[model samples]
Target: MDYASLKQKLQAFERQLDATLAALPSRQWASSSALRIASELYEIGAFKNSGTDRAEYLDYGYAILASHFVAGEVGYQADISREADLRQLIADLSFASHYYMIREYLYYSYNVPESMSWSFGEGRVEIRFSDKSIPRQFFTVYNDQMLGSQSHFRNFNHSAEIIRLLENEPEGVVTPNFETADPLMRAEADLKLAAYFSLIAPDSQIDLGGYSYAQFLNVYRMLLTKALYHRYLARAQDAVGAIYMPEGQLLDGIAGELGISLDIGRRILKDLVFDLDAAANRVDATYFSLMREGEPGGRIVMRPHHFATAEGLVNMLRVIAQRRPQTFLDRVSNEIGRAFVQRVKAAWEAEGFTCLSEVSLRDFDPKLPDIDLLVISCEPTLGYIIHVCELKCPVPPRWAKDQLKVLNKDSVSKAFRQVEVLQRFLRTEAGVQFLARVLPKEGHPHFRDFVVALNHLIITSDNAGMFFGAETTRAINFRTLERLLSRSDGDMALIQHILSTYDEHADEALVTTMVEFQLGSLTVAYEGVTASPLLEFPQGSWRSSPDRQAMVDAFIADGAHPFDVLELHPPDVVVNDHSIRVTADEEVPKK
Candidate 1:
């Protein structure tokens, strides 16, 4: 379909989805049912798989929950009683969410093919490509690459280790002011909590749902204790179940533990109970909301699914602790930047490179921006090589919706601009003077006599795939940088080659052309391309394809093998189809 027609079709679909969701029952019931469904799906090993299967299961569950939270704000009678009814609801919501996600990407992406090749009619959309390989390329870019770049839970183990160290700190120490505190000090949960607490004025009573900050913290700790207890009991008994406690006894227990009165404890529990009335129209549901009044009796119920483990409790606490003043947020960001620089410095210094952190030529040239890191290495053939490093700690973008915004802000686009500015300034006469002042005294005299090469690198805490084949500035993940640093001692040649090359190999060792993508009725067929080291291929290796051969030859002429270009950089797959046909009730064509 034409671009305008395509937009109209997608908009109609979105409106229909909204109408369907608006007609659904109360979100509270939907949410509760979604949780139960998720639990069931997990029990059936739906989450144990990986790749497309895993994505499908997660999307299915998330769609049901998200639709209710998004559109079913008004309460109504829930008629979805049978298994088949619930399954159909899930299927409908899943399709809506899944279709919207793909539609948004296709509608808003800057990388969309210039030529139109897609058609839509009778509740189906089909996209065709002139080159068979384009489908695979699309999948590799959207699915495999994007999936591999997700690092949300990757740092849990690291954060857990940090928590372990923080717990060992002596208690009762005065909490330092996070704003003016030393950036080098390891971040402690207690200090972070205190920072958040200080945001509230002493005279003003801040109500988080109902409890005061202190009471909320106490309740949080109590829940964490219960979670830990359940874990321990489960291991000992070789079984898992809810922990039911007499409501009065639970209140009294917490009261004694926190040195509070029973009346106050009761008030806390009353406020903390997951009241569906209070949570209506709110999507910010927490583990605290899982605590419920049990069976009209004087008992409280803590289900196994409610705050499953201590780790989960810690994760929730971390999220809560982050809701601090902007000043505290800035300080935390600075601390993370400092830590990343220290890590990079240590890694490079261990490999015999002169590394500097927070290097700036602003004193000598006010216009020059500060560099996050600087590394200098001497090679027998290349003399002295300097790396101008810019560090960014951006949260990796989500799989859909405003991901491009994240990529543009304080990430790939911003990093590239900063690095380019620094490089431009460094190439000037003033830049040479500043560099001369910073260079080691021993090497200053010989620096001008020998060749000195400058290389720019943008290092991020998380992988950003948008600038994968960028030529002007190299973007690399910190993990990839660490790996390269570790190998530099024995393989400086490979390191140098990577630093100078503008290709996917700069970030990852393996390069593949295999790709696939599937979204609702749309499917991109996969084509497997054998992965091989580009360094092993010679010039004209891909002569069968003139374009590929030209690319290989260009890289070979630039003092590298054809493999370095064709294998690492690979030609962009072009979709040049001009014909479009719409079908009704017809099966989707397969490759």
Candidate 2:
């Protein structure tokens, strides 16, 4: 790619975006917040400060594009930082630019239809919008609480404080009132929430049977929660060893005592309350970059174009993250698992054993109850040796919050359950059916012919602080396993011997039901709103408030037109029919 030419085009795009953001009504906090973030990211000084050379600037821009702009919102930054190459970043930038333009068009393009998707140049860029009606159940149970209006502002403002309160203060002591909060604070909160909604959410047009004021509010709230990041809390001295609230009881306490739902309570837990302590290594690299370094004029020198594309790409990433966050997370998980499993499978196959992936235990039932990788070895002299392997890897840092802690426990429980079911099947009539299909083509062997040894293994990318009760499952590091598999030179006996001696250390604390209630000096403060609030209404005016409804009715009774004049009252002026050149871009000007 011609970096210089691309840079110029990017600058042009930035200018266009700036103009569009500036055109949005000031009351539109989301638009303004997005504009601020975009502008901050595009500052030229930040981009060039990393180095004077063109390549250096490109590298910096590439990092920001991958790490901050595109994946930062949904907390998927580290993946890009470690795995993405320059070429991939460029393609992403192009796609993101196109998506950005389409997003802008969705909001600004006039006379929008029910469903539409369009391309600007040779299908290089595309955007599709299909109207989704709110679930009928949603409307039935929907209260203004779901609208999350004031809640968004409250969370944006007091998330850090809320976390602190949850950690230290008794739950009943803190009662948060998102409504009737400071109007100025509310405005600033609105802008931040708005920024996330407009830029990050996949769908902009939400149909609610008919557009109601409440519907708009609810849609914005949903987007805000999706945009919000959840940071995992651990003890101050030990970041990962003893995670805070493994069972999520603290969140439950906060919910019960504070009257906030568990969902909102969870959001408050990870709200960026304070700046990371200099020594803290727990924060995700992507978050560190976006919050501390990625701004254009700061640590990274980025142009407006880069920021624009990042915004668009983040929305694109959000779609992926939203549809299947697990699969999206497994982007790295699968990579780790596949890399290790591929080696193990090849080695075992070379040793004359059958290795399979995604082994289903159910007799063609639903997609669940499947193993990640299963190895079944049958030797005439030896017995049947079955290795049921499941892989668990750490997600990108920000994504590895309290939710991951819960998910890990659930995964282990499910894996254990599946293994048990498989074990039971092996001794019963089901084992015969399973073996007939999965066994090698040699022949079905008698159950008594071989010694059946079943081993369950959990392979991890990192040293996960998982507690295991005296379970037969072995937790082994992927790197260690990869090394072991590599060195085992087609020796199935050596691998089996090593695994047979593998330690199954069980910790009583490993169960998810175990609760640890220790609040350390988290020492993070919620950064206050810096954006200047501009109210749409006149000072002390209630014109926009509900009280204006009665005043409006009175005014209409006195003199004002009560309805649309074109529909309700005929005008004296009439236009004679006249023909003029008509096209998509031009219409005859009215006199």
Error of 2 at 228 (Å): 34
lDDT of 2 by residue, 1-591 (tens): 244553454455446544543332221222212222333323322333343222323323333233233221222222212323323333333333333333333432222233223332331323333221111111211221122344444545554443343343221232343222223333543555453323212333322222222333443333232222111111111111101122156545545544556665443332211112211433322232222232222222223223222322223223334334674464423444455456556655754567898677766445346777877766333334567777554321222132234235455445556666655554444454454456555542422222334566776443222333245655554534544554564345567656554332111111111111111221111111111221111122222346645764565466533122223222111111112212112222343
Per-residue lDDT tens digits for candidate 1, residues 1-591, read 465666676576546545654544333454434444433332222323453334343443343344343232333333445666456545544444444444434543234433224455554554433232223223333333333234322332333332333343332133342222212122223322332212232232334333454665666556654544343334333334445567778777787777767776766665444434324523222324243431245244454333432123223322333333353354434544676678777887877778888986777677767888888776433245677888876433333332344345565567777877876676555565555555566653222233345677878654433434434566666655655565455245557665565244322433434233434343433223233332221122121344644664565466642122222322111110112111211222221
TM-score of each: 0.55, 0.32
Clashing pairs in 1: 1-118, 139-516, 534-563
What lDDT, from 0 to 1, does candidate 1 have?
0.46
RMSD of 1: 15.9
Q: List candidate 2 stretches off by more than 4 Å.
A: 1-296, 301-352, 364-368, 378-380, 393-410, 444-448, 463-465, 500-591
Q: How close is candidate 2 to the true structure, as a TM-score?
A: 0.32
Candidate 2 clash figure, as a count: 13
